[model samples]
Target: MKKAYKKVDFPTEKIRKFLEPGPIVLVSSRWEGKENIMTMGWHTVLEFSPSLVGCMITAENHSFDMIEKSGECVINIPTVDLIDEIIGIGNSSGADTDKFNKFGLTAEKASIIKAPLIKECFANYECKLVDKQLLSKYNFFIFEVVKAHVATSSKYPKTVHYLGEGIFMVSGRHIAFPEKFKPENL
Candidate 1:
């Protein structure tokens, strides 16, 4: 059964929620011995084979300078279990707080980048900036994954997604189907 509903114009300023289920990412960057981590939700996968990623790191973020200068960062995927820590990290700035110590997060060095990876995360991707064309104009940076790591125990980790207004949606149970839809190289 279907029911008719009234439609109205939406506000452009509050349209972030319209793009629901945007994955929340913890970006870790280091420059000149100063390491910082920032919570990011404005990122997306641009390519598959080379694992290209695009992220918007505004000038207001402290890690923005570290990432821009070092050209490297680790995209850490945290699970729903760390929701409180996630919120804490996002709300607090790394400029004045030692987020790693304050949040009790362990850091492990990456294979290809100088930035440390958050050991508590389920997955970590060491990335290097490959494009800078949109940096000045859109505060955007394109990166290529150089190395990747996933926790064996948390293979089926439940990730978190931002829904705006300080709310989040946790990833649900896995759904699998016949293999015909999947590509051979995937």
Candidate 2:
């Protein structure tokens, strides 16, 4: 059976919901001894080698000022088990409350960055701001991953994906067919 498609106008406000299934990330930044963490969903990988990451941090976010000043941050990836905490972190503002204390999240020191890592996250990427060309126009800041860490025993950890308007989707089953694709390089 073939399903019929209907044509409808898309709303600009909700365009991101259809264009991308962006992963949820907790960005921790520190500047002049002040540290803060902000939950963000608009991030993408720009390169594999040199590990370039581009994330959008609007000027309104408190972390923006800290990140802009320090040029250092960490992107912490959380599994589905921390869904509630992710939502809480996204809902609250760091300017008003200490998210690390209010959310009961432990801050662990990073090896190469001043920003602290979220102890509960499955993985953490210590990053340094490498470019800011898009900040004025698109609010996108490019970062280079200096150090990376991941859990050793996580067999199938699922992470959360933002679907806009407070809706979320958790990572599910995996299907792999490595032999079907030819590798140019490792």
Clashing pairs in 2: none
Off by over 4 Å in 2: 1-21
Please, what are the lDDT tens digits per residue for candidate 2 over residues 35-79? 788989889777766777889998999999899889999988777
lDDT of 1 by residue, 82-159 (tens): 888889999999899888888888777788789998888776778899999999999999998777776556335577
lDDT of each model, Cα atoms only? 0.77, 0.76
TM-score of each: 0.84, 0.86
Cα deviation of 31 in candidate 2 (Å)? Answer: 1.5
